[model samples]
Target: MGDFQPEAHVKGSWGLNFIALICKRSSAVFFAVSLLKSIAQMYKVFVNDKPIIFTTSFKNEEDFPVYIYKNTIIQELIYKLKVGKLNGFYIYSNNLIEDWKDFKVKFKVIIAAGGLVLNGSKKVLFIYRGNKWDLPKGRVEEGENLMEAAIREVEEECGIEKLIINKELLITYHLFIQQNEYRLKETHWYLMFSNYEGSLTPQLEEGITKAEFKNKKETIEALQNTFANIVMVYESYLDNID
Candidate 1:
């Protein structure tokens, strides 16, 4: 966990330096094992536009710097983030799950499902809600799996039928305050396809002002006024199709 010391491959004397060489190899092996395990459980939770990444491997070459979790406090980090003291930060720990538990316990988790819909014209569907461009999604209801909920939400919110989920996309997390308590909304997204070229209807009660399919150029322009999490979903969709 200190400054990384890359394992050397030079042959050395067996009598004097054999024990030191064995110790070095052991350290390298331990690091490699920890990194692999951490990679499997990595998560990025968005607080507004800033991300709090939880992982043991400092793999991302982004501007955010990794901080050892054992030596840092979660509340302190969040406070700094709120006051604009930090743009974003990473929480690196060998015990990744335990550290994540400490962070997750801080909020009431809400699960939702939604979709990125592509039509026969190869255009993507978007909804304008809360004064920002967003994909169609809603909270998960009882007795429904993630996929069913996603399709249902898209149909109900955008008034589009005959929607077919092509594949499961990624999950995104964002925090908001509701009724004086912090809540984390976990959205499950899917890549969907629909051939319905009929009129698009935005759910009025949900405050959706527009529901329309956009071409590549229009989609790129809409991203400028959307939330960070929405951008992540669209980017993931692009990655899957490409």
Candidate 2:
């Protein structure tokens, strides 16, 4: 089978920090603080807009169903995901890191980096690929750190220059299949700015058909056809600015 990605609702670190700030000022704050920390570091994998969270903390959110990690069969969850049986779900566990390690082993993990680039007009960069609007990104290269990879990928894919990373926005995980094997892509996203007014060139070899900058209204329209993880990155950027 060719690469098939099934796509984040989390607002990233800024939202977490907001919760921590409020929790620290409350009466029964310690429990809330600890709970926040546990969830912050947990494994939250996204399928479209649905999150499969693995955590030690019990989620009382009521939006998604929760199951005990130890008692759950991973394959069953995968089946439910494929059939659209669940919007989202949680696997609660006392041992979160260990459970995450075990869970991730089921798929081949690939690390990648990307940028949400903004030019002087506050317009965002977008690429059209596989009939979907997408941001520029690619797998991390050997010996290159995530930040370096993010800059390089955007520059190469969009053929633009004079870019600077403002800060790391968030990390996203998406599952895809290639050669009949499940592969999970973990992408580190960064908020970036550029002043280059040069022509935008889409890397045709990479299947990117068009590259252009979009204003706020245009970006919103594009998001309707973009990946769920890209929405998470955009929301994270908003949080950072706010």
Which candidate number maximizes lDDT?
Answer: 2
The digit string of per-residue lDDT tens for model 1 on 123-194 reads 999999988788999999999988999999999999999999999767787777689776888888899999
Estimate the Cα RMSD of every predicted model relative to the unseen true structure. Answer: 13.3, 8.6
Worst 10 residues of 1 by lDDT: 1-10
Candidate 2 regions with alpha-carbon error over 4 angstroms: 1-42, 58-61
Off by over 4 Å in 1: 1-41, 59-62
lDDT of each: 0.72, 0.75
